[model samples]
Target: MSHTVVIKDIRNVTHDVKRIRLEKPSGYSFTPGQATEVAVDRDGWRDEKRPFTFTSLESDSVLEFIIKIYPDHDGVTEQIGQLTEGDSLIIGDPWGTIEYKEEGVFLAGGAGVTPFIAILRDLHNKGEIGNNQLIFSNKTEEDIILKNEFESILGSQFINVITREEPAGDHVFLDGEIGKDFLKSQINDFGQAFYVCGPDAFNESIMDALKELGADPEALVFEE
Candidate 1:
């Protein structure tokens, strides 16, 4: 089922990323890390569906999405960037993406962290955030979404790795990529649930590293 939702609010989280809140349909529900296909409810873009993770909790009165827009692509996200409070969107039924099975380390790159946002929030609300950690990598500090929120929730368990630009902390990742050495140094145990979401290359590399570190294949969860 598809719901025609009106945009209630839209605010920039970064230069290219926007946090959009939409009206939630009555009885709508979704798991913490699920996503839905969204389409601009405009004449020329109504059929162009793009999958976006839900950043808002299931109990929230409104649905939210943290989207990164690439203006040069001229795609659905670009169109979404142009939308405002009064605009409407066509969102599909809830679909599973990164289902959180248990507490463990989360490896995320860039906007891939969106799916984990709600998951972590859910855990925090339920007092299950302990034993869960987030290792997020971004090109620069400006690209880190909800930095303060994540840090507040995870405390010392949240690790931020800035690859391209100088970071505010000493924990910058100067190597430009996360590999076996880095994983070994940061992650002490590999037997827990491992959630990874990022570009194809990042996902592949991280999966390989986790596998090499003896992480259980069945415990690895990622977006399909």
Candidate 2:
């Protein structure tokens, strides 16, 4: 069933991204990395549902979503950019294709990092972020979301890649793609779990690269 929730707060993460806090329904609950259909509560818009990952931990009293809005397109996300506090949203029950099964390397592109946020935070809270690594790619440094939080949680293990800019030290990349050579140099064990998410093309390319690198296909978790 779908629940109608009022927006508790709205804030900007970047020029084109927003972080929204919504009221949690009485019986609502969801695990990290899960998502569901969401639509504006206004008339004629309630059916235009889009899937968004939960950026908030389950223990929190409110629900949160980190959304990347594109003002150039007159789509749902464009409308989302115009929303404000106290606006209502229709959210469906939680469902997910990505879940944390083990600690390993996480590869995310742009807003794809949303799902991994809660997963890592949950682990961090429990002091179980053991040997986990995150390789996040963005168009620029400004596009990286929750940068400080990721740095604090993963420390030196958090690696950021700026594709549109020059690479430096650990935040490096060649051709804007995390290919076999880069993977080999950063990750030591191919047997560990690999979590990946991004656009369809990004997902396919990364998964292909991982498979070619001898990473077990069964251990690679991603949005399907």
Candidate 3:
């Protein structure tokens, strides 16, 4: 089933990311970390659906999505970036494999952090964010989404890895990609649940490193 919802508000989260809020249909509900297919309500674009994770909690009055736009791709996300308030989007049923199993380390790369937004928010709201950690990697400091919010929610547990431009402050900077050596050095316990979300290459690399470190395969949660 699909619902046509009007955009209630739209704002920029970063240079290329947008935080969009839409009217929530009655009875609409979804778990944290879940996503839904969304299509522009415009004529020819109605069928060009893209999966976007819900950044809003299930109890929120409006549905929200934190989307990263690539204008160079000239794809759905680019069109989404141009959409303004009052625009309508066709949202499909909620579905996703990434969900919170327990307090653990969350590995996210770039835009992949979208799914974890709601999960962390839910935990923070319930005062159950105990010992949860977030290891977010981005090209630069400017590319990180909700940096302040994550820091507030997770405190010193929020880790940032920058691979491109040099970060300004005392943030951890990585010249190369996240590999076994880095993961092993940063994470001590390999027995906890590992929620990983990122580009294909990032996911594969992290999963392989975690498995090699003796992390239980079943405890590694990610979208398959």
- List, in order, the clash count of every candidate structure: 0, 0, 0
> Model 1: per-residue lDDT, tens digit, 1-224?
99999999999999999999999999999999999999999999989999999999989999999999999998999999999999999999999999988889999999999999999999999999988989999998888899899989999999999889777764556557888889899999999999999999999999999999999999999998
Each model's lDDT comes to 0.93, 0.90, 0.93
Across residues 21-107, which tens digit of lDDT does each residue of candidate 2 receive? 999999788899899999988878899999999999889999999999988988889888889999999999999769999989999
- lDDT of each residue in 54-88, candidate 3, tens digit only: 99999999999999999999888989999999999
Worst 10 residues of 3 by lDDT: 164-173
Model 3 regions more than 4 Å off: none
Q: Report the Cα RMSD per candidate.
A: 0.9, 1.4, 0.8
Judge candidate 3 against the unseen true structure and give its global Cα lDDT, from 0 to 1: 0.93
- Candidate 1 scores a C-alpha RMSD against the true structure in Å of 0.9
- Ordered list by lDDT, greatest first: 1, 3, 2
